[model samples]
Target: MFDVAITNGLFFDGSGAPGAIRHLGIRGGKLVAISSEPLEEGAQQTIDAHGQWVMPGFIDMHTHYDAELVAAPALRESVRHGVTTVMIGSCSISMVLSGAEDCSDMFTRVESVPREHVLPLLQARKHWNTPADYATFLDSHPLGPNICSFLGHSDLRVAVLGLERAVDASVRPSDAELRQMEQLLEQALDAGLLGLSSMTNPWDKLDGERQRSKSLPSVYAPWREYVRLNRVLRKRGRIHQGAPNLVTKLNVFAFLWESMGLLRKPLKTTLITLMDVKADPWLAPILGPLTRTLSRLTRADFRWQTLPVPFVTYADGMEFVVFEEFPSGEAALHLASQDLRSELFRDPDYRRRFREDVDKRFGPRVWHRDFDDAWIVDCPDQALAGHSVGELARARGMHPGDLFLDLLVEHGPRLRWRTMIANHRPKVVEKLVAEPATLIGFADSGAHIRNMAFYNFAVRLLKLVRDGEARGQPAMPLEQAIWRLTGELGEWFGVDAGRLALDRRADLVIVDPQHLDAGLEAYHEDEMEGFDGLRRMVNRGEAVRATLINGRIAYRDGEFAADLGQVRGYGQFLRAG
Candidate 1:
């Protein structure tokens, strides 16, 4: 007998096709049938998805859940929103091939997760030393969703070169060291990792007393080192998740060129982001066309990840990564002591340099840096009374840059402010997401804990399309939207997921399209259960009526199964195909 049956549901099948009313039978963690015929009546459980749209569960291809997957394997935050698969080891951080301390240092600062919680958990439980063992560790845990990961370049580099030497800018890997890295990557691929994820973004820093403020180890590698590793991925027909040196942005073409098959088999490259930033209005318009040209003309297979919704980011005093874009801001953050940063914030010389940079408005910044664009969302000081940074600066007759530094000196971390960094222009954002060379991503889920809240990005994208179609300006077909979050990504990543074919793994969600609305944008907080009262920003919505991972209803009827991560039924480690 089938374990479950979903009847009269609008099935999308993750194929970018129109949804059709169908009945699906699930048996033994696989799809039993995909047909319009009536489901045989004797299923042990049944879901009457009368009006709901059933599709393959959304795949979250960008997440920093590497540590959280260890701390709380359920990871209900993404699962609740219909994400049944989560990709970790993003931005050159992964748990494989590194010691607990090294992994913790590499991750905590860049991802903004608490090291105190992550480090100790790893120190106690992290015994695995290789990619295969890491996969085994995950299998032992009651994972909430299928997990796929890239072998982080930083992890391999640090493991082979020692953390001290890896982060040192002057220390280049020897030929021997490069071979070791390749060997580790080969091991990772053999262990079924998605591929290699590398970082050229200098803003992502390492944590720990020794490596503090140093950019991730991947940032220390030279172009030759990267090319050597990229070859391994290319040869294996694996993906390369890359981020350009954002400060310079010249590396973008370098990555794209490597993705071309003109001289060799194209490496399937997917880069971090393409957004309509307020700081550079011309960038997105140019990039969309250029990327499409490269994709078609070069016979290259690469996709620029795009966020489908508005990019709102939160910052507390001076703890945001955008600061790393400029010298003065980076100097302040480089200080290990919070008091030192505060003192530097008030230093006249430092302020002079920062103000000069602000006036010049440095090229290629994600944040607009306009004080008017940022607002004080929370502050303990009663006198300021929730004014935008620009208002406070204007009141004091000081430049917004100068006033912002002064605020940091006084109310660090306690003073929370938010800004719409990019993707704020709805029409422009709609077009950007629709680009053929772009993929629906950059959700940055499980990263930027305080700074971002795009957990429901999939639903938000759906909502964006739904709202647009209602106004008679459809960005693309709704079926296409679902496919972007589902089959497109799953196919690209080579995961055994994101389709509702008969006999396929029963991984799907029931989305209530009628209830999908603006409420999905609302953000709230849930205290991270094991993390010493740390509150994480999360999205809450009713659109996801049910999420089934491998034939089990992990979340349904507005409630998560109580035993989710405590039991093995919810999910298991999913190796890359």
Candidate 2:
């Protein structure tokens, strides 16, 4: 007898196979049977998945749920959209190994999570001091989705060499400190971490009293430090997840060189990201040939992470992170006090510098300085809503850059705007989605909560593939797309939650294909449960009919299980295979 049964569903087993009519039975949190014929024995519960597509639950490859996982284990934001497994501790901000204060400092700014919310929560609820302690805490929690983690390099550096020394560029770790870092990494791997995640992207800065606004600890580390750490990952056959310095992008070759396996085993490396940015129209095309060349010419195991959908971003005034990428914007963001920020905004010198920075169109940047691309979503003056800031600036005979500052000083966060950050060109994005060397991820799921809304990144990817095919511009076959998100990522990172086969863990999703439409792209917000009236940007849609993890339906038909967040049986920690 089955504990739970799904019948009459067209299931794709995450093997890149075409859909087949199949019935699956779950028993003791494992797939006990998968058959073409309906099961003869009836069980405790049954779900008639008639027209829905039953596939292995989607795996979110990138997220910053370190704090949210502690605050709200349900993770309904991602889980309800069919994500069964979530990879946390990406972008060099894991909560493991570091003290709560240090971890919170490294995290809050870069991820855009509020400092007050995260810091206090960590101070109160956090007790873990090492990977094993963190892992044990997770084992006891009723996790909404299976969790796997990378040992964050910033966390390691901060733990070993105080936050000050960690971010001090002149203060390279002594051999003893390096040894301590290596030992911590080893202990993490022993406790079943995926691998190391480092950051060279100077844009991601620190948040807190100490080392305030300094680049991440990993950024301060010399190449030798990464080499020592990568050695451990290489020996263990684990993965190295990193980001190249986005401003210059010259450090990418070093990461590439480290990945080569001409004589020695190549380090399995994945970097963030591969985007079609409006700022650099040439980047998307050049990265293609570069990726192909690396794949063809070198004996390296390297992959570029790509977001599969349009990179539309919603910002509450100037509270977005991309502002931290440039010097002038960084200056404004450095002042945490609203009064000080306003003073800076009022300063003519600051405005002139900002305008000068904006004028440098050829300068390397992530946000194109063109304010014309951004449209107001909300404002104190309702008439300004839905109008591009640039056009209004032109109408007022003012530079777009000047008007941007004026509006920010006038409205603060009461104003909201949306802009196309990248992947605006459909043809280029379709090609990137199908790029074999590029992984379909970079959703930045749990981070940038107020400014980014891609909780349903997996669903978006599927819709992109489905619609593209309908438009006679198929990126890849539907099966292949499924495999990319599920089995392919699972296999690469050694996480075990992707495929569906007899005896495998019962983690799956039932997707209603007809509901995969434009609604998934709708802009919406839900007040973050713990934070008082803190409305976070989110995606709302009816695409997923059901999501099951560990033989139990965690979400079905828009209703979450009553015990989804309170009980321990829904999901657990997924160790690397």
Candidate 3:
């Protein structure tokens, strides 16, 4: 008898075959049969999958759960979205310990993880002291879904060379240091880490804030290590990196080419979301030529993922304030940057240099642009949710800047606004989404805590592609979208499970796609730590009826089974084996 059976279901197997009407029989948590034949003796349980779509569980390739995973391993946010497996340690930030030295300073500077949040956790509950040991800790925990990590290059840089010295572009590592990092990478790979990942960007606070003064060395570390590590991995595992900054576009293109050259094998490297911004018009200019060259000459593989949404939702009255605008707004921000931000604020000549180099070139554009009263979708306070800060300002007869400043001042560092400025038009999204080499992603779920609304990416795809099909400009086929979100991602990463094949691990999500709406649910304060409100989210397959990991139910109905004692350690620790 089968352990479970789903009858009358429309099954779209991960192989891209046409949908077939069949009943799926699960035995020992793997799909054992798909036939019209009546049940053998007696199945333990059955589900009427009627009109629902059943496919492989999703694989989220890009995520930042560095600190959060240490606290809550159930991974509620991802499992809720039908994501059965998630890859973290992207953008060169890793949670693995390095000897007895306090690497907390490295995280604060490179990744912006708050010292308060990281230090306390490291001092208290963090048990692992090396990459391999950290992987062991994750294996020991009761994780709800499968977790495979990458050895972040930033961590490697700090481990080999001190954080202070690793940033220098010319500071080539000593042969011993290089060998040590290589050994560390080998250890992590043997411990089951997927590959290495990194990101490159200079600091700039969006919202038309002041420019971040001084160039740091960490920026060069990621690019240098990309070539070094790819040669070592020999394309055994994939490399994931994010390169969205305009200032570094040229550098990014060069580094991408360098990494591809080093691969010299049929291996894939995924570049993060190519944002739909006008300033980034050269995305195709760079990728188009590179694709042609790689197909004709190089045996390497290159791919990109797109978000199909704005960098941030502008409905929250948030807009990206480029560093170019910082000079004009320098006076206000510099005064504001005092005290806690005094390290950067203390340099008066640097502020003067910013003013001279910045304001002289872009004076009128910063002064005259009208961003007065734009409609907003959600706010921390429900009363102010839909109202614009500009409109509120006019009603109270104050300048829009004052209203914006007041909120930032009151909310302090936590103030954030979603923006629609990146790709203000749908045509841009359509063109990018239809590209063959592109996959749908850029759901920076655990990152950009105050600024980004990540849960909306899946819903946006449904709305734009499914609902907008009549326009004859749909992004991708629903079947392709499903595969891209699930099976394809796993195949790209060399993970074991992104399909419903027999003998494979059972990590699955049951989602109701129809009721999924394109609106952000208000903040619900129910995280494990009780850290106030987080934006409540529901995607196409959000109302997860059940989530199974390694043939056991990890989460079911509305509660996490790990917490409910339905299963013990349903998650499996994946190694290179």
Worst 10 residues of 1 by lDDT: 358-367
In candidate 3, list every pair of residues with a backbone clash. 167-217, 207-321, 208-321, 312-419, 313-418, 313-419, 314-418, 314-419, 314-420
**Candidate 1 local Cα displacement, residue 230, angstroms:** 1.7
Per-candidate local distance difference test: 0.88, 0.89, 0.57
- Candidate 1 residue runs with Cα over 4 Å from true position: 382-386
lDDT for model 3: 0.57
RMSD values for the candidates in order, in angstroms, are 1.5, 1.1, 5.5
- List, residue by residue over 143-167, the lDDT tens digit for candidate 1: 8999898899899998999999998
- How well does candidate 3 match the true structure in TM-score terms? 0.80
In terms of lDDT, which candidate is stronger, 1 or 2? 2
Identify the candidate with maximal TM-score. 2
Q: Please write out the lDDT profile of model 3 over residues 386-465, one tens digit for every residue.
A: 67666787888865555554564444334444434455557767666666657667676565444444554554554566
Which of the predicted structures, 2 or 3, would earn the higher lDDT when compared with the native?
2
- Residue 300 displacement (Å), model 1: 1.1
Candidate 2 global CA lDDT score: 0.89
330-430: candidate 2 lDDT, tens digit per residue: 99888888778888988999999989988886766888867888999899999999899899999999988899989988998788998888998988988
